[model samples]
Target: MTMTIAFAGTPTIDDAPGIDWREQAACRNHPEPNLWFPVGINDPCDDAKDICVNHCPVRETCGLVANRTRERHAVMAGFRCSDPDEFIDLRIWLGVENPARRTRTCRHCGVKFSTRHPRRRACPECRDLVPLEPVHRHIQHLRNVGKYTLRGIAAASGVSVGTVSLLAKGQSPYEGPYVSRAIAARLFAVTTEQEAKTA
Candidate 1:
C-alpha cells in the first residue's frame, strides 16, 4: 500500500492546488505546531474523523503526511504521537487544544462559529435571511403531530424519507417552490388562520 501511494504521481506540489504544501511542510517540522491525525488504525471509534474533516482545510495534505510518516494508527497531521487507550486520555499532539469541542468555520466568509444545537450549518447571520422550503415546513408539522420520525412523515407527505430527515435536520437548505408551497399549506394552516383572525 505504501509503495502504491508513493508511486501515485507525487501529485506535484502545484498539481494538487488550492492548498499550501510548503507552509504545511514548515508546520510539520515546526517545533510547535498543530497535529491533524488523532486515531490509531485499531481505534475502537469513528467520531474523530468528524473533527479531522471539519477542522482540516488541506485535508489531503494532512492525509499524505500521515502516510509519509508510515503511521500505523490514524494520526491527524501530528495530533497523536502514539495511540492512547481512550479518547479522553488524548493530549495535545500538534497545536489544537480540546479536539472534543465542535466548531464550524465558513469557507466563504472565513468566520469561526460554535453551536450547541445540532442540524445547524451557517451562523444565524447566514441563516436568518434564507427562506425555508415548504416541504421542510410540512415535515415539521408531521413531527409536531406525533409522527416522531422522518420515515413516518415522509410516508404521510409522499416525500422521500431522506428528504424529510434533511428538512427536519436543516440539512436540505435548498428546495423548489412547489415543494415549498406544499409544506406551507400543510404546516402553517393554524398559523395562517391566526393571521386571518388578526387581519
Candidate 2:
C-alpha cells in the first residue's frame, strides 16, 4: 500500500478529542475479526464492506480516520483501500482531502479521486491495477479446462468477486484489462480442479 502523510489537518475521533471511535464501531464485537484485515484474496472479507458501509453509525468517521491515517488495509466505510489515493479519495468525497485538492471521478474505477494533476484520469489504485494477459489466460483456463465458475474460483481462491470481475472487464468471465500485481499473483496461484486432481 502506498503511504502518505495524513492527519495533517483533519478531525479525529469526535467522542474525545483524539480518542479512537472503535468502541462505537458496528463491527466491534463481530465474530470474525479477520474480516477487516483480509490479506489479498485468501480472505476476501466481502461482508466487512457491508458492516462498514451500511451498519456502522460512524462510517463517515471511519472513512475520515482511514483517510487521515492513509490506511491501506481493511474495509473502511465500504472503500477498499489499495493505495493512499483511495484514502484521499474518501477524504475528497467527504470534502476534506485537502484545502487545495480538487475531486475527479476515476475513469477506470469511477470513484472520486483527489487530484492536483489535470491529466490524471484514474485513481492511483486503478492506475496501478492494469490488467495482464496471463491472468486473463488463467481465467479462461478456469472456465474452460478447470470447469470452475467465477464465483467458485473467487470463494476457493479467497479473492474478491470484484477483483475477478475487474479482470474480466465486461465480457462475462474475461474481457477487461485491469488487475493489480497482488491480484495477479493471487489469481495465478489459483488452480483448476483438473490440475488439482492430477496433482
Candidate 3:
C-alpha cells in the first residue's frame, strides 16, 4: 500500500516533480484544511465542499483516486464518501443536487418569505417601515453638537465604525436598502442620553 501525504506550503505538482493528485485540490492552502474531514456520514463543511465541487479543477481525478484507494474519513472531491456505496451516492448528489434558495423571517412582521438576495432579511412589506431617516438625522445632530467622530458615534450607537461613517455620509449600512431596527434604537438611545446630559 502506498500512502501519499501532502503538506501545506509544499510546491504544487506543476512546480515540483511527480503528478501529485493534490496539486489542483482547492483545499490546498485553505485556512481550515481539516474541514475536508467528514463528520459522521455528511460533509461537515458545506463551504469547503462547495469550493471543491465548483472550483476544484481535479475533482474527478481526486474522486477516482479516493474511490479506488477506498479512502474513508476524509473529504475527497467535495464528497464525504466513506465507502463505495457512499461514493456513488456522493457522485449522484453532486450531479443532481441544487442548493435550496435561502429565506429569512422578517424581524418586524413575523412573516417568512424567500428573498431575491441573501442580504435582504426583512420582508418587503416591512422595508419601508424601518425608519432610518430619523436615525440618520440624529447621528448628524450628535456630530454637530457633541463634535462626535465616526468612531465616537460607532461606540455610542454600538455599531461598527464603517456603519457610522455610512450614516454620516447619508449612506446605508452595507449600502443595503434598509437600516436595522437595532441600529436605529441604539442611535436614538445615544442621542437621548446626550440630550439628557446637556439638559
Candidate 4:
C-alpha cells in the first residue's frame, strides 16, 4: 500500500496576549478543547476571525495585528484568508502599498512564502529543518561571503533583510523551491582557493 504523508504548513495558532482559545470558544459558542487545536487547510469552518470581530474589544487592533503579522490565512472575519494567492489578490484589489515584495521560495520544498522581509537562503518554514545537505552548503556560502548583515545583503540581493539574516544565520529562507541558484552557483564557483592561487 502506498501511504501518503501529510504535514501542516500554515500558522493558525492564536498566540496573541490576553486572547486564548477558551475566549474564542466562548465567543463562538464552540467547545473549548476543540477550538484550542490549530486549524489546518481542511478545517475551513474554524472562523477564528469572526470570533475576533465579535468578541475582541480591540477589534480594529486585533485585525491590524493579524494583518500586520500576515497570520490570517483563511476566511478571517469577512476578509479572505491571508494566503499567498490571497495576498496577490489583495495586492491587485487594494494595491501593494509596500514597495518591497517579501516573497521567497524554499530549496527543499516547492511551497512559496510571503514574509515581512525578503529571504536570502531558505524560507522561514524551512529554517532549521533537517532536510538535504545542499541546503546547509548554500547557507554556509552566505556566511563565508560576509553576508552576515541582513539589511546589507537584502539591499544588495534585492531580497529582504529578514531573508539575509535567516540565510546567514543558517536558518531556512522561505517556502517555495526557488533558491537563488544562479547567484549561489556564481558565488560558490569563485572559491577562495582560486583567488589565493591567482595571487
Candidate with the greatest TM-score versus the true structure = 2
lDDT of 2 at 194: 72
- Residue-level lDDT of model 3, residues 6-110, one tens digit each, is 223223323224777575677776767666764443224567679878999877766665555556666777766653444654545544423455678865445
In Å, residue 81's CA in model 2 sits off its true spot by 2.7
Q: Write the per-residue lDDT of candidate 4 for residues 17-124, one digit (tens) a residue.
A: 556432433233444423323243333334554564565554443334335556444343233444544343333333343346567675544358765433233454
> Which scores better on lDDT, 2 or 3?
2
* Per-model TM-score versus the true fold: 0.23, 0.44, 0.36, 0.24
lDDT, candidate 3, at 158: 67
lDDT of 2 by residue, 154-179 (tens): 87666667767655553322223445
> Model 3: clashing residue pairs?
none
Which of 1 and 3 is the better model by TM-score?
Answer: 3
Which parts of model 1 have CA positions greater than 4 angstroms off? 1-130, 133-138, 173-199
What is the TM-score (0 to 1) of candidate 2? 0.44
- For candidate 1, the 10 contiguous residues with the lowest summed lDDT are 1-10
Question: Which scores better on lDDT, 2 or 4?
Answer: 2
Give a tens-digit lDDT track for model 1, residues 139-171.
Answer: 565567554576655555554565456667655
What ranking emerges by TM-score with the best candidate at the front? Answer: 2, 3, 4, 1
RMSD of each predicted structure: 16.4, 11.2, 14.4, 14.7
Q: Assess candidate 4 and give its TM-score to the true structure.
A: 0.24
Model 2 residue pairs with clashes: 41-158, 131-177, 131-178
Off by over 4 Å in 4: 1-38, 72-82, 85-199
Clashes of 1: 15
